[model samples]
Target: MSAVLELVEFDAEGFMNDAKAWTPEIGEAIAATLGITLTNRHWVVINFARKEFTEKGEAPSLRRITKTTDVDTKEIYQLFPGGPAKVAAKIAGLSKPTGCI
Candidate 1:
């Protein structure tokens, strides 16, 4: 785990315990664990996920992301690799997205 991870609390699946406690630094640290380096494009998705979480009180699904953001399904898969919505939500410091299996 990174130093930032050590300072925060997460669930067994590694989602942050509190979205309110999330910071950009912490998001980067979480992404590091998944071997992801946040790019501007990645931030687009992350920021959108955070916004969705704030608005809906839950992380958005992949379909929702693709439908709402400029990013498409293929690019989201390319960017996030293993389960776009789930990974993006984790990095965004939100709970595991509903309906993600």
Candidate 2:
């Protein structure tokens, strides 16, 4: 199967139709993918992910995101196709980019 197809099939919570509406379950899925503990302290990941999509017009790389957050890049890529960027973008309600997604 294609990488994107496989990514879509992975056990993430819901589809990326609306990340802003993501529930705790969705957040947990994103956090699990990034190998991070999702406590109240890390809520910024969701907000940052949203900001990244709005500002950069693209998902932030795992490296770039981890530099700003506590999530790990290696663990993120292991779970998601394009790593933290993709997962973060999805959770942030951003549309999947053409080639990247």
- The alpha-carbon RMSD values of the candidates against the true structure, listed in the order shown, are 1.2, 7.7
**Tens digits of per-residue lDDT for model 1 on 1-101?**
88888889999998998999999999999999999999999999999999989988999999999999999999999999989999999999998888745
- Which number leads on lDDT? 1
Q: What TM-score does structure 1 among the candidates reach?
A: 0.95
Error of 2 at 43 (Å): 2.3
Location of the lowest summed lDDT over 10 successive residues in candidate 2:
1-10
lDDT of candidate 2 vs native? Answer: 0.55
Clashes of each: 0, 1
Q: Which lDDT values do the candidates have, in the order given? A: 0.93, 0.55
- Which 10-residue span in candidate 1 carries the lowest summed lDDT? 92-101
Give the CA lDDT, 0 to 100, for residue 8 in model 1: 93
Give the lDDT of residue 62 in candidate 2.
61
